[model samples]
Target: MMEFFIQGVLHPLLMPAHLLLLLALGLLVGQQGVGALKPLCAVLLLSVLLACVSTLHWRLRLDLEVALLVCAMVTGVLAVLRLELPRWPLILLGILAGVLVGLDSAAPRIPGLRGHKIHMLLAGTVLSSTLIMLICALLALMLRHLLEGIVIRVLGAWIAAGAILVLALYLLRDRLA
Candidate 1:
């Protein structure tokens, strides 16, 4: 049993398990049910811990997507609160943040854009990436405002996405089982 545990499980693949737990925690918090805050706080705290773990000298690297997702959520919440801020700018910032630190393979190379002035080039790339996310979010906010009828469509899309993810999880679980 111990050998089986060591070889088949308790490895890097557990990362997915961690993500699933995070998703469940977020959805539960959004629901605002009993004991919600506890789990929400725990999830947020765990995320921070995971992020920190990735930064240390150990071999394991924290996944960039987790960091991006956390940042995205934080910025999203902030954007909603600070309605006065230009929406497009905020969205563009978000996209840049997401792409730069998003654990995507292409993110790091972008910093080397300029031949000799690597620092300047990288900074520009990061700025551009963030600008794109902010733009997208801003556009989304604008569309939400302009077409009142589009909200239904937005809601439907969100629901459909959730359903698809659930189905995917179920299929994966079945295969594993």
Candidate 2:
């Protein structure tokens, strides 16, 4: 039980796609300025909860990795550009990102991980993912003042490049195999 919970907590950090999406989304949100933080956070929390519950009940087998990478690429580009987007678009992106993260973070169908144990794992994942997003966003926000946002933009570009490479590799995986 404890082991599963720990695994759940580490899922987002361990998964490359998940971590990239979180970082890109966080930088994007941070670049949106302080005014957008609260609402985006709220939307992210709600969407993540709903997506996780839906995944648990429905067990949707969607190939969310590609979707997640696409999102990361878009967000990374947006961050690199540092566009001053309106509130609605940021909220929409937040919802999309939150849902993707939640869906992808679902516990694997391991034997013996039934009942409350599964719930425990999910709970830990949800908590850790949310906290990591918040922390990364806050870090980006702080760095904006210290470095005149250059560091953020550079990180965004790196993220975009990385996502593109990984996405290409993922798409060609079957061919490679």
Q: What is the C-alpha RMSD of each candidate to the true structure, in Å?
A: 15.0, 1.6
Clashes of 1: 13
Off by over 4 Å in 1: 1-60, 66-117, 149-177
Model 2 residue 71 distance off true place after TM-score fit, in angstroms: 0.2
TM-score of 1: 0.31
Q: Single out the weakest 10-residue window by summed lDDT for candidate 2.
A: 106-115
* Model 1 poorest ten-residue lDDT run: 100-109
Q: Which candidate number maximizes TM-score? A: 2
lDDT of 2 by residue, 1-177 (tens): 887788788988888888888899888888777887788878887888788777777777788999999999999999989889999999899899889999987767777655677777777777777777788788888887556788999999998899899999999999999
